[model samples]
Target: MPFIPHTDDDIAAMLQTIGAPSIEALFDEIPAALRSGERDEIPPALSEQAITRLMRLRAQGDEQPSCFIGAGAYDHYIPAAVWQIATRGEYYSAYTPYQAEASQGTLQVLYEFQSMMTALTALDASNTSLYDGATALAEALLMAVRANRRCKSKRVLIPRALHPFYRRTVRTIVEPQGLELIEVDFDAASGQTPVERCAALAGDQGLAAVVINQPNFFGVLEAVDALTDWAHEQGALAVAVVNPLALALLTPPGEWGAAGADIACGEAQPFGMPLSSGGPYAGFLCSKQALVRQMPGRIVGRTLDADGKPGFTLTLQAREQHIRRSKATSNICTNQGLMVTAATIHLALLGTEGLEQVARTCHANTARLCDQLCALPGVERAFSGAVFHEQALRLPQAPNTVLERLASEADLLGGCALGEHYPELDDMLLVCATEQRTEEEMQRYATALATILNAA
Candidate 1:
């Protein structure tokens, strides 16, 4: 059925009943001086076929190639059922569960998402969301400062190996609050955060927190356990910025050290979301029990009403966006409901074994590709440290130029060039291969990269 409410005759009858001359007359209470005339800028409405053709032409220009880029947004295979069910009227149409009773479905879905995230992070509690991974890290950093009442200064220790965009975002969000982000340089040989360097920076800084990535931006696994301990020894809270998919195969933040990470946050996009250009990706923030109240975003709780039936409802309803201005835990506007819904379904379908398989497959594929590609001339791994699914490789030519050639000439995305962000890594390209990538795809990438490098 058409969504348009009433026919012209019905609208006329209703207008007559309402004692209004016409629809425009009903709004005559406003001044005529404020009214703007019809717009000539808007083109005449095109037929459905014309609109479809136009859109198709535009889409053809941006069709996805054989993707190898994974700076932050990853290309993953989402099951068809994930969206078909998520887009259903019951799940898709619902908004935030402001009223506990009316928004039970939304509340339950959020609750499930939180539970799954907590399990993935091994943290005591998980907030429904933040804006995205970068902002999520910022919020987690803020929570760390608030949670550590004993800490006097609002200084956060960040590793240079963390995602460049994430670092920029954290600075944008937290710098104005008098929080100093001390970026500790990574080890030249390993591409991992140098624990000693960070330890020295945290020394006597009265640091509120230390942020670390599991697999740093170069995809080299950091010495998380030692680093977590070092941060605690310096009397700073450890906040982990991680990749959710990597956690399935690696140690989770909460299990990092003897004390565990006080907070954890990361992009949940790889769970099922596609790299639709960059995003609409969900950011997950999880923290220990002591830091729950200081965490951002909404939390849903399972409860039973007086009737004795089980139910779900919104909890910690005291966020600043909702009401309490100065006392709010976070100023985030809204949650990524659609993305979370899809992620929740993806997780449910891919249980522990399935998730592990996917992670292992990605690692195996990446290792295979790296070994094969490194055998070729002028291609070598940038770091000697153990890596995950993604790795940075020093290219023979300018990374951006080569990547462009690969994309335009060979129909391959190849990888993200690191030189722009980290000028020291002049010819490095960070490449990622997930479970979605076939062996043929990996070989093709290697062959093309070798051919490009070996050319005159």
Candidate 2:
């Protein structure tokens, strides 16, 4: 039997109290056409068993060919233990820990996450987490502006090779705040932003920060040290949007120079987090201790209990909205807790050596793929700079046509075409290679691409 909450008299009485003759009268303000004028000509709801069978059939029909795409989101391996622990009722349903005194477990996990990120970035401290890499970068730019005392030097230099979405996000956040964004061009041959060229733009006194990506959008490593030095010499902060996986093999941004990096931000999607379409991913923000007060999100810290046992609690939250109104450093209240938890577990499971192995595999796979593609008759390297896992290849044929043909005729997912974002590279395709891809799969891609280009 259907359980009804309101009887006819009860609804009528409630409607009368609001001076409405009937329930339908409450919606009179809505236009007649906009209302549910025509009922959905549909079938009745099905039983649970029938619904399950129908859903399974739909899922099967929607399955696609194997994927080889990874622009920002990747297809990496996640250990069973990660889901096993993350699915615990307590962890899955946990909410923000308002009262630290009774939330030791949640606080401790967050504290460990912060510590892990700090150690990885080789920075003094890190926040709990943020929405994703793009927003973290946006917040970092804002922090640089505030740290510089909101000087007239509100100009931010973003390298042209940074991810297109991230660049747009930074502009969206800062343009309304009266901040100026200047995009510096990268050498097409080197795929690295020319530091000297950028230095020329650093006039006397209006450059707040310079933002560059490590292993930039084209997958080529930038001359970060030179760029960081030039920015600091001009009294501007250096912000890097990094890939956490590459940090395992390359030098951390904090070690670039004395004034080093004022802030480091990046996507943590490669860290055992599933590419659930594009997100529900975590972003990490780390900076020197001097700028902690202006840092964006909540940070978890370790402490001692009343019994002198090791405990945890939310620390340095005075900069948040609840504590300071308009003066708050950031209005970001909650974080990606479950995602952060997954990252924490994945990092713990991998440890130091295991992470290095993962990085090595990704690098090796990418090198192999690059070599094969370069050897093809119509394919060549877009840039000569050293890369980690992804690379851009210049093709003789239109990349979009080739990609469509590859998907439809060959039943294979292809790389992202650069023409969609940068018209200058109409025939360039950006491809990624992860540890999950087998050698057989790489060979298949190579043969299919070669055949398609030859036909074109």
Candidate 3:
């Protein structure tokens, strides 16, 4: 039997109560042309084997091109075990733990994820997860505004060096709430947000926070220590936007300066999440325990139950859904649970040393590829600074022209063109070479780029 919740009498009673003559009257507002009249014309369902074959045929149309673009989403090798375990029925179908105590297994995985994030960021605490890196930064900005008791002003110093998408997302989320985001310029030569530029804002009385992106959008490492200290000197919180994998090699935000960054957040896509065409990626947000209450999303905590057995439960139900809407710390309704599960398993499979190795390999490959590409005529470094796994190269010809030719002729998904966002750097192309890129692949890319440039 089809599990229909309402009987004929129940439907009739509901329609009568609502002053509708029949159930179809509810959708009378919808135009007849727009609606499918009936299910009679629907095709018969295919058998299991036939469906599988059809899906395979459809899948063949999708091309897995060698990816080099890493604006925010990354391409990293996921150990087969990461997804195999994450996609298991137990972990895959789990949702937000609203009941708290009942969903022990789901809550435990989230707890582990929080623990891992704190460890990686070297922060006092971490929330379960957020929508993605961009929104996480937006949340961090809002959290800073709420938590900074000393700075009453909603003015935040945001660097142009931060990812362009993150900056736009932050503006969309916080501007309506009366938060003012002040744009700070990066040193053109270094692609680093100079402390001197931020220092000018010292005279401004109510600076809420300063946003710092380590190995920022251009992949050039920022002077985080100087920037963090500068924000503190101005009576503002320092919000660090970071790449999770880079934390393994670079100085974690928790140790940025004499006092350290107050909050750290970024995308966890590099961990175990695949770049499924820029979708469903996980974001992580960590903060000093002082700002924990102001943080958004679900926070899973572990403790012992009455029987003295260990247990996991949701702590700090700060969203509007759980608390009085007016008193809620954040309007965010839920966290990215499945992505967090995959990240937890990914981190567990690759311990501290293993994660560090991956970071080192990514850096090494990027540096090598940068060197090879720069050797070609008209191809030069866009910024003269040390980078992590991504670098911007100044192409002789138009970036789109080169990218289109590379894709059509070489079957290569070329790097992102900086022209769209940074008009001044229109000739530049930002590329990344993760640990997944091999020596041969890098050489191929270099050769293809050279040919395209030479032809142009």
Candidate 4:
């Protein structure tokens, strides 16, 4: 429906019908200071053409930097058709599929998204979506505590090598709920959380879950099979925090160990979404079939309707909005519907082989970029281990300083500085090269970095 603002006459009529003297009278219960004071507070309305021109001018002023920074969110090539289909009238405006009979299209899109996620992770089931990767892991931790009946402890072992932001988010979300998140340090040489470290904590502590991030925060691959099995041996659920794109090339969490990970969750932004500033990204969470009821958010299922025709509707919704608050698995009210829609469309367009090819190209490009950057004097790989795409490098000069020079002098984004997050790695920079990055762009970055270092 198009927006139709009320005119003075319309407002007055509505006010009279409601026994209100004016629109202001309706908000009399609110404090006068809190109420909007002036019409000037709002920007002046413009014609459609005028607004388009204004937006174009504003966009022109913005710098379109070639981004190489992929801590969690990534820069991947999005097909033109993905958004074209996703933003169609029905899909774009749809929110939660509260009315199943009337929302078959929306429900089916979510159903496909879940199906794809499960296939990507090799898990049994998946939720519709979540706020983002960070919050999704938080929800996964909470679910782990609930689903692990054998382990009575609320303690969860989180690797320090996991994304720092995700760790903080999990703490914020689960700490108040009486969950204990024990930090397990990563090996300095490998940038991986060694299974032995987790083994040390495996006695009678009764851990609820252990988080394993494949191609961890530093982009160094972890011993997932060993770690997954270790968690199982401890009778704790293995919570795998993964990169959805990397899963195309690496072992899926469900096939991680002898038994496999119980839960797998990660950012699904690379599937289609752009790094608009930072986000509007979606998170995907998948788990074993036994834990489906404990998984937060809705799950869509295909069924035969009264006419014996195929239909899609919400099969399981564990959020507080769907069930009794006390019995609810999570308080998350809704999924990132629009982003999920785009991702589903993207996956359908790409298929399995296309996605695997993208992942392989990203890995190859990143490897080449790393080799180029490391060839320069006083730059070396920060950690020694296999990586999917991203890599952390040690530079002679301060990373932030070099990054500033790269951005200003060469019009390059360079990469993320690791000093602020890991003080021990004060001279390190984390860089990534997705399939979007070309040979010329990588060479440009290397030349720019070498120039900056030589000048220093």
Candidate 5:
């Protein structure tokens, strides 16, 4: 009976404790139309061996050749050491360190992750972690409103070139809070947000924040200093969502001005995490010391233990959901611990030089791919701008049809089509080339794309 985990008697007893006759009674509040009216066709049970075989067959059918998709998730190489270390039982099963003494190791890793993020963003402080880049941007906008004392004129300006998901996330979070979301146009020629136009828009709105992505969604780096100054003059906070790996070659958002960015947030998937079909990735949020109090997630701090030895503790609990309840800075309950640990270990393994090498290879590989793609008959750069690992190109034919042909006929993943988001870019394809991409891979991609276009 115990092997069943929840026997009929146990379920009845539990339901009795809750004053419910049956499980169906618990769902009375749910709308009738939304509830499932019937059961699925799956068998009630199967032997362990049969289940294993069925799962394996399904997995085998799902496997495909190596892909080149990088709309946001990338296909970079993850070292064996990353999985080897992360899979250790202690780390794999650990929960949040509510008590610092019992969680010294986890706390220390979080503390180090915070430190590493600070160095990467060149900011004074960083929280342990966030849900992901999109949520982090949402939290950052909320933090800006908090820092500005919930001014009615609080407006957050986002660049058109920022990740589409991040834009939607911010809108979702801010609109409910009565905060204004202003979308600024990017220079179509350069794929960069025109700071002058942004400055002109910032006039007297009591703007709370201005967000721009470095090596933006199109992979074009924005003029951070100009944008930062413009935002500051309008009494607004400057937030930059940066690519963690790209920070190795470019100046961090923190270095844009004297104290750097008011808040710097970005996806940490490039570190050691996998695409895993777009998640579960980690997001990092960093800010100057002055604004550390306004950071949404947990903050790990160093302290001295009873033995007078250096120890780590989760500091700044006042900013979290438990302490503040509905009044908390953010309702983000769980920090992405496993992913954070992987990133910390990955960064440690790379050190300073290794990160730079990764960044350099990304740039070089992208440049090579861009050149080859541009030489195709009807393919051209979408924007005549400097870029990093990803670039956009205009194709003569419909991007979606061309992409389908590339995948079906040429056995390629092809590039992300832009028509879904930008109507004018119906024929544009967004492609990315990382360190994992070789010269041969680049050539194959170009040849496949060109062949598809010519045939079409």
Candidate 6:
């Protein structure tokens, strides 16, 4: 009666085989006083139409807002075909390629994704994917430390202007392994990490790596080429944390220095993935081919079987799941495959030229929005450096209070406040407008902030 898979006879046979009289007899060793005495409080099933109506009513309770916040996640416009094609029965899956033959489609899609990323980063190789931006950054830092055989110091220079969340994550992952994350200061005025400070670190022996954020936490573009060169000169590996979209306009990390950055990694959410309450997103890591084995996560490669037909298979799977934990490059077991599939479909449809336009449009929209917002009486640019799609702005009062006022009183989701992550910039708010934001929406945001400022 209880929806058990086995019939009474089968249950009896199983019970007899297990030396139990009945199902209740199996729990004889357990104390009755601690057991749940009452049935779960579940309502009776509703009619289909009633269920649909009820769901609609519940959905109406949430007021979906036009997104304006882009500290790390941008609200880029996703084309209809991106998800439509990606969700096709064969493509929509959450499985990693454990079986080479059965997973050719999955493996091929991942391989393609890798190729696209390598081309984008101008690096020789890319791993399949990682969990998120933070973990990928953690792995990249660890990779640098592992690769630096000559550099005795396991100290990696992290810029103060790097995203606070990422910096924290790196510290959590690396510090436990006895690797030090040294904070490098940025130029106070321009919000860019000073190359001179990095050069100064070079004099200190045993510097393993330097982490440079292009279009850093304040959304100010750092002098990447200079920073990369400094790291290389110090005999330290340069790990460039960058936004994938901005690479369309700025120099790719692979081409950043005289020798280029040793590693390139960043968030891939802007590539047609929704900022679903800060993800379910993917992080991508790319390195020059020389460090391919050191790259964490999985790699899919094109190959030929005995028939000499081209096929896809998992290659360079350096994880605890594949090898022993001690030998694994990273303990990161799985990847955001669904999101990667979404991104692959998204990029394939957009192509190189289309993606370039999307990047250009985001920058253009943010620039226009920046001009309008800064024109407000109490609002001003927080930094002098050029930005791509986001920037930190000086506000009249604490940004948290102002952002709260805007969101509740005006039904608007304002940009991220800097006070919590960046106490030094207590009066700053990181604002952004992607290509998805219209001129009208931008004006409304500015107007809302202006009204709040005037009231103060």
Best by TM-score: 1
Predicted candidate 6 versus true structure: per-residue lDDT over 210-279, tens digit per residue: 8989889888999888888888878899999999988877899899989889899999998989877788
lDDT by residue (114-137, candidate 3, tens digit) is 889999889999998889999999
Task: Kindly list the per-residue Cα lDDT of model 4 for residues 92-173, writing each as its tens digit.
Answer: 8877888899999998888889889999899999998888999999999999999999998999999999999999988899
> Which numbered prediction scores highest in lDDT against the true structure?
4
lDDT tens string, model 5, 1-456?
A: 324799778898999999998989999999999987657786667778888999999989877554666767777778889879987888889888888898998899999999998998889999988989888888888888788763457788889888888888878877898878888989989888998878767757578888868988888878888888777777788898988898999889888855467899989999899887778899899998888888899889999999999999989899888999988899988879999999989999999999999888877887788888889898898997788788898889888988788778766777788888878778888988888887777788888877877777
Candidate 1 per-residue C-alpha lDDT over 229-289 given as tens digits, one digit per residue, 9 for 90 to 100: 9889878999999999998889999999898998999999988887887788899999898
Task: Give a tens-digit lDDT track for model 2, residues 321-392.
Answer: 889877887778887888888899999999988889998998898789879878889799898888878889
TM-score for candidate 3, residues paired by index = 0.90
TM-scores of the models, in the given order? Answer: 0.96, 0.89, 0.90, 0.93, 0.90, 0.90
Range of the 10 consecutive residues with the lowest summed lDDT in candidate 6: 316-325
Backbone Cα, N, C clashes tallied per candidate: 0, 1, 0, 0, 1, 1
lDDT for model 1 comes to 0.87
Q: Is candidate 1 or candidate 4 better by TM-score?
A: 1
Q: After superposition, how far is residue 60 of candidate 4 from its true place, in Å?
A: 3.1
Off by over 4 Å in 4: 5-54
For model 6, the superposed segments whose C-alpha errors exceed 4 Å read: 1-60, 318-320
Candidate 1 versus truth, CA RMSD in Å, comes to 1.8
- Compute the lDDT for candidate 4: 0.90
Q: What is the C-alpha lDDT of each candidate?
A: 0.87, 0.85, 0.88, 0.90, 0.85, 0.86
Model 1 lDDT-worst window of ten = 316-325
